[model samples]
Target: MSNNDIKFIHWFRSASPYIRVHKGKTFVIHMDDSVIGSDNFTGLVHDLALLNSLEIRLVLVFSTRHSIESRLNDHADVSHYHNGIRITDSETMEVIKDAAGKLRVEIEAALSVGLGNTPMLNAKVIISSGNYVRAKPMGVVDGVDYLYTGTVRSIETETINKQLDANEIVLIPPLGYSITGDVFNLQATALTRDVATKLGADKIIYLSSVDGISDQSGKLIKEMIVTEAEKYLLENKIPDAAEQQLLSHAVYACKKGIDRVHVINSSLDGGLIQELFSRDGVGTMISSTSFDELRQATVDDISGILELIVPLEKSGVLVERSREKLELEIENFTVMLRDDVIIGCGALYLYEKEMTAEVACLVIHGDYKNSGRGEQIYSVLEQRARENSIDSIFVLTTQAEHWFRELGFDEISVDELPVEKKELYNFKRNSKIFIKKLN
Candidate 1:
């Protein structure tokens, strides 16, 4: 009925795939005190409620770093850290317990809101929190006694899983207990990693102060595999301490068999939903495998390839290709896939006798055309041509002449076409011929 309505409909439709896949999958989310106290906290809670409604099992692990600092400062007590970990003495431990308890209650209250005419209306989200984590003290290291600072020794997975099975969100505070009736402070990042790994969660997400992981040039990296993330950490490429910590644990979680880890700015409203429900999320994702893949197409990809190109074909921007033809020529195609959907594709037809190749059916999905996906597909095709020892490559285009020209292709006469292609050329199309020579 309106532009906004249309956009909303499109977005909802686009998110349907993610929604389907995320259903019944467990996601472990880690948030620091910064997120709990942020202005968008309520909105984030609402999004999480929506996820629960969609049948996604949620495990929320929260830290109270800022809260503890505020309490310590109020009491005129100084905090200590060794190797970036807070050393919690008797007094600071009391502050941590107070902060964590208060914050957990605040989060629970926020999640329980369901006022009329509000986002949470009719959304009754149940939350569960308990001594689900068991801890062992870090003990003494390097001749320093680190009392009360601990690591996760084991998790009460059966109890947590029972809560999840009942469709309740499991809220884990950054505090663990020992067999001797002692409480210990735990790092939220490490807790998130251990929880997700132990529970075999589908994803581990960090809602943090920073936007996401970025390269040294300050460009946001949308996706990276475990190895690349480790390289970044090893070289100290990530500048933000928060992001560095998250990345370090993200690498660990992925290596430990968690399929995906996402880090997004908690201050950004609706970021949780966007990161979960969109094709290209608003944050960096670390996975054990590539999230988006560009590789040679197989016969199975003919359907996705045709879905991408049929619109162009109908618009007369390219010639029509039947499914039968696509199946036969699928081996000649390279496709760019996002979540296993072909978003961009091109085919290279080599004329080995003439030492040339034809780049054909270059198409990018309408949603991704502006994001340089076309160039990525073209680069792959060019590489393929070189690998095959082609002296030059060409394209016949009724449109996109300017694009080819920008890629260093010069206009050529149809008469210069390879003898075999010249005979098969469509004179009715009157397409321009562009060729790029490799030397």
Candidate 2:
């Protein structure tokens, strides 16, 4: 087979797990009006159609900021705002309705394409849109009347759910209707977060201009949980109000019961699919448990610990360890868990008199081995050793010598081990010893 063909097979296999996991899951995607105007918008539509074909329930929430602003620029009146919210007067409300309606139709046409020139070839996507969201007036916040600007009051989930179950993509505009028969302009981010929360969606994805939140050094902050995200805003001043607002909504969503929120650069080709299918996604992921912890193992984790290591033991990569021995030495182990499931683990066996520790059993789950979980487990054990006043860390391995060497470990003689450990070393296994000196 050709090399390119082989690579395709490998990538397809790698993507299979994500496809299985995401099928039948509900995801709310927020698209900025800026993205709609980009050259890559057609590609984004194709990707969304692929998601539809894969049986993913989709709720598309679209923002009209750029669209409405473009329309307002044609008239003589300047746009007015209070606290970053557009003050939608009678004329501005007319512009809002026209722009929203125009974008909705264009999007629907894009989703309905089946001319065989695109990925939608012969596939039909049914989409629904309407008054599924109700709103109430902002009631003059800070004494500035938000005339036609409103906040979400209640979501009509049953109707949306019914449409979703019927395999129809639900399209939501950034507007809501009230009981008094008036259309109100809505903040797209707030509407998206609220709808996802009310529907108990599995994810909220924002297709944005920026890749994601970045640190002062311009490195992408790939993952942040609710608490950490809140701290970042306080510690680092984000000069861009748009980015700050987007991240604020992400944190709010995580706190309000949504576990996953993704912000990706929609301008990148296939970015939406890349974020969903890849192990290390192409954008920022604000999760509820981004730093899901490493804690000292307890008696309860014995079974999970064994489950993680037994395969390695069977493959002769690790020396056999027994349940009784593990139970007795459980205090030396630390486990990494995500959503309460053990994903990685390592142990720190301290040599008190020698002021050293042996880092052992750094096992990560089979599917997640290369995603830095093992490295994280190793770091946690190293910190544990330092806290215990150990000046060096060591490991004995039959299969992971190169892996350790890459992480700053140096091959060392077995005789260089702490006296007690040297005496108990299993000579028959002929394991290699590697050591790292702590600073």
Candidate 3:
């Protein structure tokens, strides 16, 4: 496809549950050491690069509690999972250097090459170990002595912000230090949370192996709030440790005033794009409540509404309502506009003391279909009905039965129509009768 097509797709995917956009916002991505060799890494880098192209500031911190040498000595058997965190033993720690350091360099090189090729990639990307992290070693708990594990004591927020302001991506290795000059291994997820909180980032996204957040039937949960997530977690239905971490981070981000958080599967092609731009995102979105209102259609909105319904009218899916008719009833029309662009429009025709009004000409732009705009327009008409003290609303649609059904409209027989409407119905084009009760 062309560049414009790609951009349109990008915008569509931005509203998806799996894709998230922190436009003019700061974000921190915790890249677990295990993700280094995973198939998802290349796509992850590309997605991050795409974000950079959009001028959204971000930081990527790689964390590994085990050194590469340890993994090699252990014959690469040091398994890592759960919230993208790797469990490390003494043998694992010995080989972690191979994964964390050497592997980091390779990843950095790959990102550099990729960025260099893209005209949009101009941000400075810095790669460093936990050299700047002030850490405290973990203490023994229960019957297990946590080997080289350490938690973040402090992150140099000033340094991070300075880099971010300069349009740089900061990459941190999972190595931390104490005031006494002791270095320790750290969990990638823990460090990511600490740094993101410290930086007051807009979001913190975790790309995992599983398909985003799922319901009891394993279907993805599209949108949710922290309270809902907390309830889900309390019921022990979140399913896995990774999901638990995603929920924890989402709650933390919400509590800290971060706009939103997302957890998605990295393996899916274009998963990031699907999550960030599409209305029904691929993964789950934990966000604050959103309330939408409809306003009076403006003069500038006429052309857009006409364009939206023109195709349907041509195909006989909708009746051909002339622009002259629209101009006359302009005051009775309501429109849904996003960024001043009309995505949907509908009209209300009043009758004197009839206790009902006709809700006609509902149309949503093709690109914005399935975005609930039609329902929003219908809601506006219902509110108008209440204002006018009308008890019910009527519609005549040749198609769109399911759409009307979703709005609580019922299929009423032609005989149910009032005398005046029935007379008009007989003289006018063929259409199905639909009625919605306001009371």
Candidate 4:
């Protein structure tokens, strides 16, 4: 894989539950201009690169509104409120064109670079607005006609899908035209959500200028299920305006069967990769209640297993074990597999005592790292320990101290080990002792 592909895989492993759930399926990426400045944008690019490398079918959609230059020239007095509401008058409609037009060109330019200069510029970028969106005017809600602003009446899903199938990235400007040929300015957020819902996208990621959804304490809310996000919104737990938008998008995505949605900062370097590839990501992920399982390793699983471990072993992040050793001990191992391939694996060693055992050789395949596969394997091993009447389990690892610490394993001096274990420890290469009590 290329560097961008590796970065993308890392990000996917971190933030997306669909990585495990939606194997061999197509993905549609919806990004807007605001995403251009965030660290998450780089990760988004990384994910796109990865999908390309893996030969996964992907549809990348870039949405934008008009440019500030056009808007200013058209409506000299129009301005936007802090809440993202535009203060518009009759003249505002004239300037809306400039803003939306300039923004679209800028977005296309960015995407061209993001796609690795892959000829996306010359490639067909279906840019049009007409019956593509059926909208009704947001007519005078209280005493205002709400001139030029409209809500979606319907989206032409078939047309969008046809272009998506042709691998043409759809670029939707916030300007939409009615069948009667009247031009109306639309909110980018509203348009994006409508398009995503209409298309039934697999994932909808919102890249924002802020640090993502946060609790009252200002710490980033890393992951949340749909129910938890609703409660947070209802209770006013989210602290900022940016977070509120993210929560709203997340809830909308979940309700619309988008499967998963991510709200992350766009300014941080590798922000997207951290969210997609690592377990403790830098943003919030909202999804449904889908828990994956760990299974027994099979003979056909060796290649993927090797791909995961070889790099780590070469860099000494994992112990160097021969393929023969792995094949022989394959029966002693349990793996977290998705789509008939192993994403994670670990070994269980049975000791003589009825209530004691050792869990060792834990490894998460490189591409699958940080997706909680390691934790799943550990949970399974703990259950197996109970089944075998093992009261406690221990592990020795040179690295991954923090990982084991987070899982409730406390460090113990080597002197506390059983005589045989201590002897084994002495002969073993790199080691740190971790013990977990099972009752």
TM-score of each: 0.75, 0.73, 0.63, 0.61
- Winning model by TM-score: 1
Ranking by TM-score: 1, 2, 3, 4
* Error in Å for residue 252 of model 1: 1.3
| Candidate 3, number of clashes | 33
- Which has the better lDDT: candidate 2, or candidate 3? 2
- Model 2, runs deviating above 4 Å: 291-362, 365-397, 401-439
Query: 142-180, model 4: which lDDT tens digit per residue?
Result: 565666677787878888777656554556666667777
Decreasing lDDT order of the candidates: 1, 2, 3, 4
Please give the lDDT score for candidate 4: 0.66
The 0-to-1 C-alpha lDDT of every candidate, in the order given, reads 0.89, 0.87, 0.70, 0.66
**Could you say which candidate leads in lDDT?**
1
Better structure of 1 and 3 per lDDT:
1
Name the lDDT of candidate 3.
Answer: 0.70
**Model 1 over residues 343-384: C-alpha lDDT tens digits?**
789999999999999999998888777777788889999998
Task: For each of the candidates, give the backbone clash count.
Answer: 0, 0, 33, 20
lDDT of 3 by residue, 1-439 (tens): 9999999776654343223224667877765555665777677777777777566777787655334535554665646433354445665655664567786786677577535565325644444333558887675555445656667888888887777776767777777778986666787666777777788887777666567687677778877777887788888877767677767777776777765677776666677766665555677778643313368887666776786677788998787779998787788889876423456788888774678898988888776778777877888888888899988888988778778888899989878877787776744566878899889
